[model samples]
Target chain A: MSLETPLHRVEGLGSSHSGVSHFWRERVSGAALIPLGIWFAVSILGLAGGHYVSVLTFFSRPLNGILMAAFVVISLYHLVLGLQMVIDDYVHSPGGKVVLMLAARAFALACGALSLYALLEIARVF
Target chain B: MADNPQRPGHRPRPLSPHLMHYRPTPTMISSITHRITGVGLGLGMAVLAWWLFAAARGPEPFALFLSLAITPLGQVILFGFAWALSYHLLAGIRHLVWDLGYGFDPRSANRWSLVIFTLSFLAPAGLFVLAYTGNGGYYL
Candidate 1:
């Protein structure tokens, strides 16, 4: 019943006549996050109360390192988008909202960079 | 009632549905709490990123983070973060379901709102229980 390709964003034919790009992208990233979130959560739980050696050894694996990097990237992408929407809806002051959005983006980027550095350092990829 | 001069509690109001004009339903509260928990999780990500960055720095820094993290305050914060992340995940799933054009009826929507809250709390509490009970000693 649809003519558009899977590549195209949906909801472009309504009365508003615009695509739901933000909503679409958010959902896509969120769908991807389910497994990543589960992996991180359960793995963290397993490491619970363990010592530094255990933690280091866990991250030393190449697969864990790669998954950690993927997790950080997707999470930061989702985080920035979610924060932008939150600020846009709630912040009444124009200038303040813009500043907050920029700050949120900066925070996500920082988190992403730090996470990658740590994972790579643990794996001795550098 | 506000549109009629003779009606009681009459007052001018915006044409659109104003937030203050309605009673707070579970769905409404859940919608807002989704954002609140989201912001909480965002802040929690700072802690996570710090943990990773510290680990990369050295064992000394890693131990320093652990020293602080095992403290009462830090444990509390971490617990809150866990709860917030679980809550957001459940809430996000609910939103995704709605996006797929299901659970739109008021009855189902409200039920889902409560379900999300209940499961969100329960899931983390269960995980924390298992986490803290490992090997009759510190598991982390």
Candidate 2:
């Protein structure tokens, strides 16, 4: 009997922590990744055919290690956020949506952890 | 909705345009590609972590990584990642620009999308060349 539109009924419902903070985070993380990602890509190209020692040397450098770790963390953060949006779009079931969302978060966290760990271990000589 | 009793035959309301309903444009394609690449790069993150894992494990494992990377399939994956990253970066920057309230015109939007697509392929190809052949054969 309610005249309220569906959007009116659901507005600020269903995981509304606040206004578009999820969106804002995506943009901020994405913006940061532009520089970090570019640096990582070009550096990898520099090492492209390089010997094992050269890679090891690359890892050993303080700046390279720091930047690689930063890039990995931010990239994964951006990725999971993007995945969340995609899942929200296509997944209709509430349970399925939550499952997919959790899976995305787990995937990103694992990847980031391993990346950071590897960066640390590879640069152990420093 | 199909279940709504107010409808005589219980038919669903006509939905908005689905994929097949409308003519596709550069803007549309670019948008879908951006999302696809975004997910694709999620998978790429695993590869990135795997690479760092290999690198951290020392020379033997690192050599294994290099060997695999030099394979044809591995090259394809690497090149795909390169292109994906490039496209996503450009598209992401475009989003940022749009957020700032620029480039909303259809002509400029379409043009930027084409430019993004073009650079995505070109940058990766160029980088791949520079990496494999440009600097005296691959790596050190």
When just chain B is superposed on the true chain B, each candidate scores a TM-score of 0.82, 0.86
Q: How good is the docking of model 1, as DockQ?
A: 0.45
Off by over 4 Å in 1: A1-18, B1-17, B135-140
Scored by lDDT, the top model is: 2
Q: Which residue pairs collide, candidate 2?
A: A49-B138, A49-B139, A49-B140, A50-B139, A50-B140
Across A30-75, the per-residue lDDT of candidate 1 in tens digits comes to 9888888888788788778857877777788888778778877887
DockQ-based CAPRI category assigned to the predicted complex of candidate 1: acceptable
Q: Per-residue lDDT of B8-40 in model 1, one digit per residue for the tens? A: 587655465678988999999999899988888
Predicted structure 1: lDDT:
0.82
